[model samples]
Target: MSPTTRASRRRRPAAVTIHDVAARAGVSVATVSRVLNRKTPVREETSRQVLEVARSLRYVPNVAARSLSIRRSHTIGIVLPEVHGDFFSEVIRGIDLAARRAGYHILVSGSHSDRNEMLEVLAAMRGRVDGLIVMSPDVALSALHDQLADQLPLVLLNSVAEGHTAITIDNYGGAHAMMRHLGTLGHSRIAFIKGPDRNADASERLRGYRHAMRQIGGRAADLEVPGEFSEESGYAAAGSILARHERPTAIFAANDAMAVGVLSAVAAQGLNVPADMAVVGFDDIPIARYLAPPLTTVKVDIAELGRRSFEAVIDRIDRGLPDQPRHECIPTSLVVRQSCGAATSLRRTKKASGKKKTTRQEEI
Candidate 1:
């Protein structure tokens, strides 16, 4: 070969085809396709040889063409409000695990809490996916019903939509329990840092905090602080609480992300956790355990929630059962840690009270 021939050959795209793989493996293209699709079992040795040859040739199958032939994409679409945090990351990991086990791929898109963006993402996925796992807290159920009406199978995660399969956490119960626990620990002056106002989970948590506050004989309206489920919002809420003439002895953020912010704010004020102030949060994200005081929080199995959501959507898609029950609630549990100082502070309070009573009795 001459220099000119070598240059032309280098520029040419060496595309590998299934027919080439089949020929190299001494099999028909149909046999190769069947082996790849698992449509029918092939002899073990023959299947191994075919796969080996395909890998040697660096052959890639056309999923689009396969979908055209089979009328199924074998892809699941995941739509989320945001995709930056540990919560969403864990959910995606679980979804990926289940999807791969079911021999399906995932197409993930984040709308960043924008309704129009979510609609656009859904529209783009119209004919490209077999089912969807949607986690849109700000989007309305009416819009979802109108837009996706009988179009594609969908499972809602952390959302409430009528007539759709959903997997959600026990936000209200978890928050209520945390508040009641704080009360039992002598934290009557507790403040709540809320999530986004439009979020369903945030609303439920806020309601829980208020109800629990009333049970403890505290005024809910005065202690509530607004947050957007972001660290910045939590920091801002903490600052607002600190600026008050009377600061709360403890603060509970709606989520772990915001609770982290509260920690930063408290540190900035040169205050110590549980001594100067106590802190607690929901969603025991990985960092919660590693924090300086090891934050107290409500634990929701976020990854499990995602796995169940994908399984539910897959069932709806494969079984074609519209009458199946569509709603599920994942439970949450309280995890007590040093951040709230429920154990140490309560002991100290009781000890100090006992000492005071003893001193008064001796004087009498």
Candidate 2:
């Protein structure tokens, strides 16, 4: 062959096959297939070796051929209300991590929190995925039941449906804990920025707030301001609260994003955080701790929620759905920081103890 022909042949390498992977990894062809397709469980070490060998050889599985033979799609569909926020990103990250390890791909779609849009997305995913993980807190369970195919395994995140696996955060518990913290700080006239009216998580948090307020003989109805879980809405709600004849001593935003806006609004009014107006939020997003005063909020393991939901769906896909549907509620914890005046209280305690002032340690 000519020099040019030799170079071209070298550049265009032959495709690596399953047989090649099995031979290199010292495993049977069936073992290689099992590991690559994840259709059956293989020994952990052997599976790892086969995958590593395949990767070293730059082997690519023929997904269409496999699907045709097995009647399965090695992909998981993830439908969420919105995908732009940090919370959603974290959740996706977790799901992706699990999916990759299980030799599956993910198809993510945002439904814009609209019923029609969600149904359309579901329709598009019909035959494209083996299972689905949906987070539609605004939609009713009955509507979802009517839309989804009965055979497709599904896991829900932050939503509940009968006869389906679900993973949800303890929104009510988190909100109630925050309320207790605020009450302990003697914040009776606390203002709350509510999330979307129909959202399940939002409703649960609102219920918690009301329940906690009632326990303390405080009126929740007068101090609540509507928000759409956006920074702009939070800022607007803060403005409304600040404009009132009797301003609240503290503001509790539904989530960290809104709390950020509340912080901005408070600053624009020439007020100091924790001192002039204590600010708290829920869903401690990554940036919550880095905020000016370091926001105190309810901590939810957002990524773990995604990972768990993915696992639940994959389990159903692999082992078939159980007679009893699984429902998991992830616990939330309180994260105390400067934003809620916790640091000030700590400093006072230290001063009284005659200890030098130190950086505040976050309480969980």
Candidate 3:
């Protein structure tokens, strides 16, 4: 309870290991190893006793030794931008579930959205992990190019950097599709809250928006606002757009978080969604469906993205990058809902192009 006691508790010895189990069971180290690895069948009662002793001591097998024996870590290292968003968490959950089924554990690292930290994470994972998975990285692609492709089997998720196995949604197609959907609903003067400038995914999304606006036969200049993929930034940026006396009838945010913020900001000004100022977001995070008048956003198959990315890295690690399968592409689509000038029609969500999902690629 006291400060000294708390500090001492924090400095306690690390968790008990296999040797502790062996010593407690009065057995040789090899016996303990064989028991855990099931290399040979020990007498049932003896195996029970050893397991009981290990349990009592909270003894855990060493991952390193097991990996060395199998020539595989049965573990993968995943580096993420940050843990704050649903997008990252959902992908991680999918990866974790698939990895667990495949008899692997995930060692995760957070780069905290910094370039140096990304490098540090990559360096830190070099030898200790079997494969690597990184998302919308903050590091320069050039720095990761040579080493990432050869040194380790790497998967790039939600970001497209060359020389690594990549699993990403159709960023350009999704954005372009969503914008066209808005135009279909009679929203012409649309504004955008762009995602981060340097991030590859964000850049791809913004490019799609610009390209779509051009397709609508306009210059598309000054159609975007400087905004990060956060609700706070979206809300704050809304103020400037509203104050400029040049309000657009619809707004598109690069991701759902910013879209939610835009909705909140507009509502605060006594405006409405779709009716007054329509909103569309990308990457349909969970909250998108639950909002008042569910958000009409682009649905990216987040789980498949994670699973494919994780599997790609493992495949590249176990068997050198295969030529047959280079990159796994996840599809995205405009989910029409009440928020984007569509009638309060949840049934019409899957289609904005007035077509149904006919291919497995489109569904994914």
Candidate 4:
């Protein structure tokens, strides 16, 4: 317990810092930092030497210190109204992968479909993140316009909320296309399942269906059911649709979850798809192909939505806002599987064959 022995025992290993890495590599702390953060390109030899020194010293850059100096967290945030599972996760993966490629990390939170919760999350995230990306936001568009829109870089996905930059599929076009596919299938008395009323994307899709149905059949009354983007809502809607004495010949669910529910409802009523009643869904979810008849649905490139949303925020963060608010309307197309995307190919093939058959008859 001598004082000298105690002092020696109390001594701690020197914690490695960026300064140490720079000194060992014979470079400036800035150069060492650029190399470690991968912020800027480094000469091959210098990069190798710096990396070697950092590893030798067990060096790790302090992100907070770096952010403090740079005024950037090298991070973004994604707030969601409903981030169910597969769909949101894939979108997030796309955003994360693209962001990392550009040298950034992400912060994520869910809004639980609560307006107050969304407001709280946005308030809490204020001034912390470099940018924010929201999916299916529940905030008032006017509030976003007046108060928070210009505060930071913001991008919105599948949202009714307004943004300086936003990305979403053409739900109206996609829905109209789907309805036209059903029209060609001899489905005059088609049924429609509607998604949440407040959701801008769902509302546009419903409008598309109504308009397209009018084009084909002149009216869409008694041919639509309500849905809520969930299996339970689909099931409930399906039950009511089936209870009708004059049921629809075909049913187009607003989304795949509703289509699956329709499938169950159809089975309960002892009806087979494309035989007794054709069923179609939207979103082209991964499980769509595995269904009994495979759900014919509209496909939105959800990954691209996520990737583009991230890009939108990054662009805004780098450059000031555009003269006018930028609103990007992404394109969506019908996927022609046995359920829906394939409907056109099959009909075309059959028509070509029929034409050939008629030609042979004429020759004979």
Candidate 5:
């Protein structure tokens, strides 16, 4: 309890500071800050050395302090309909890549088909993020515009909201192309596996299918089966299609997930793809190419879509851009594969068999 003993026992904090990191790396405090914030270019070797020193010293940046000083968190918010699927995952991967490159972070939330939920999510992110990218399948454009407009810098993905910066895939065009490809393969009796009723992309795709059916001038089977963009729905829809008095020569599912379901159902029924029923899907998911017969699908660059959406928000945030909304439509293309039956081979087979080309029936 002596005064000298008490003084010797006094503890000192071991917290690592930026100055410690800079001094160890032989760099200025400003250079350390720039390297940590990624706000300006630093020499590659110097940046590496500083990072190494920071790691050795266990220096953690004070994000709260930085945010207070800059009045920005250097973070972005993402509002999605769901998060578990390949589509959402790819989109998120793209967003993460872009955000990391620009020294930003992400806060993601799935609205789960509830408008109020989406609003709540947005409210939670009100001041936390520099920008937001939303994927709303159930919420209408007008509702989104009314609620989210001027609230923050925003980018709408897979849905078109008027007067907001938006990016959307060409669902209609992709569907149309799918139908045309099936028609070329002599699949006059083509069944459509519809997507979720609440999604605009689903409706647009359906419209495209119907439009293409009309143009093909055939007795296109008027069969439209209900689906919720789920594999189970796709399986059930396939059952419904098969139960019909006249089976379809081909089936086009709205998206690849459902298409996978249809493939499973078809296999369960001991039917071979293309031969028993040609199958095609949209969104060319990663699994498409690995399916039993490989899927013929509409290729949408999902990851690229996510990357561009993030970049669009960053452009608005960094460049001090105006609040005027912008719209961009990403294109789609058909990827021919065995499931849909090769058009050239089918024609050649028919020609070799000396079979007359029969006129298509108009069923749509």
Candidate 6:
């Protein structure tokens, strides 16, 4: 060929293929395939040589072809109620990290906590993922099972569905513990800002509060106010609670967002937190610790929950679905801070009685 013709051919770079990599590495195509897929073990030195040659040649594997051959997409689908706010972000972060470590990708979608929307998203994900992680607290388990008839590997996050693996936070235990802490600090007749009625987590937390109240011989029905698990709703609920003929000395919000709203509402009313009206919340989001009087809240490791859910679904994908479903509930703990007035309550008790009583030191 003429020099000019050769230069033109070089300018039109052709896509490098596995064949080129194998040829340059002086290995059979099967050896190169085994090394690249990592499905079957190969000699370490040979594997390194194949990888180095592929990198040097800028050879890329055809993921679509490989997925077709293996009958796996090597991707996980995550369907969450809503992908907004710190909680969801943390969960996504955890899943993404785990997925990357396992050489898998993730597809995320939001269902807006609506059954129809969730079904639609699940339908769209068919054949596009190897497994799924779903978080639909408001939907019925029966409805979900009916729609997922394909028996695709699934992991439920913060949800419950029989015959499927699930990873959920201990919403009831967390709320109950918080209530006990408040009661220890002498906070009876505490007002509760409840989340949406249909949400599972919200219902569990409310149940915990009610059970604890009954245990202490306190009335719960009268001091409860409805909220949407939002800051604005918490603010509105707090305002209504404060205007009551018999105001509560403490308010417990369902989540950190609402707790922030309660704090703002309390300040707007010229009330000091913990001193005038103690405040506490569930789900210790990142910002909770940085709040002015740092929030007292239930600590749920949101990211760890995500990581575990990812691991569970991947496990199902590798080893087909188990005959018996696995149900895992992550525990929660109380993180006491300035907002709950535990320290203040202790100080008052000591001064009034002229005797120092031992109490757990407050958590920063």
Judging by TM-score against the true structure, name the best candidate: 6
Tens-digit lDDT track of model 2 for 1-364: 3222332345555456677787889988799999876977799999989999999989897677778888889899999988878989899999999999998999999998888999999989988999999999887757767567568898889988777789999899889889988999899888899999999999889988999889988898999999989999999999999999998899999988899999999999999998999999999898998999999998888888988999899899989766468998887777888898964443212224333222123552
lDDT per residue (tens digit) for residues 247-361 in model 1 = 8899999999899999999999999997899999999898888987889888888888989998998898888756555788876777777888766332211225432211100
- TM-scores of all predicted structures: 0.83, 0.81, 0.79, 0.83, 0.80, 0.88
Shift of residue 161 alpha carbon in model 2, Å = 2.1
Query: How many backbone clashes can be found in candidate 4?
Result: 7
Give Cα-based local distance difference scores for all models. Answer: 0.83, 0.86, 0.76, 0.75, 0.82, 0.86
RMSD in order of candidates:
9.1, 7.4, 7.0, 7.4, 8.2, 6.4
lDDT of 4 by residue, 6-76 (tens): 22334575356677677778898889888877887889899889999899888877778778888988799
lDDT (Cα, tens digit) per residue for candidate 6, span 8-38: 3455565666777777788887899999879
Give the lDDT of residue 263 in candidate 2: 98
Error of 2 at 34 (Å): 8.3
Flag regions of model 3 displaced more than 4 Å: 1-61, 146-150, 321-325, 346-364
Which consecutive 10 residues in model 3 have the weakest lDDT in total? 355-364
- Scored against the true structure, residue 121 in model 1 reaches a CA lDDT of 86
RMSD of 3: 7.0
**Across residues 1-364, which tens digit of lDDT does each residue of candidate 3 receive?**
3222322345556566666677778887788877777888787887888888987877777677777887777778998988646878888888998899888889888888776777788788777788888885456667655456556677777776555567877888888888877777787778888888887788888898998888787557777788888899999877777776767888888888988888899899998776888888888888787886678888887887888888787787777656443676677766776788676533433344444421111111
In model 2, which residue pairs have backbone atoms overlapping below 3 Å? none
lDDT of 6: 0.86
* lDDT string, candidate 5, 1-364, tens digits: 3222333234675356677777778878799999987877898998899888998889997777778888888999999988879999889999999899998999999988688888888889888998999999778757555557765788989887667788888888879878877877787778999988879889989999888888876554467888999999999999989888878889999999999999999999999997899998999898898998888888887888899999999988987757677887777767776788774232211223333221111110
Candidate 2: regions farther than 4 A off: 1-59, 344-364
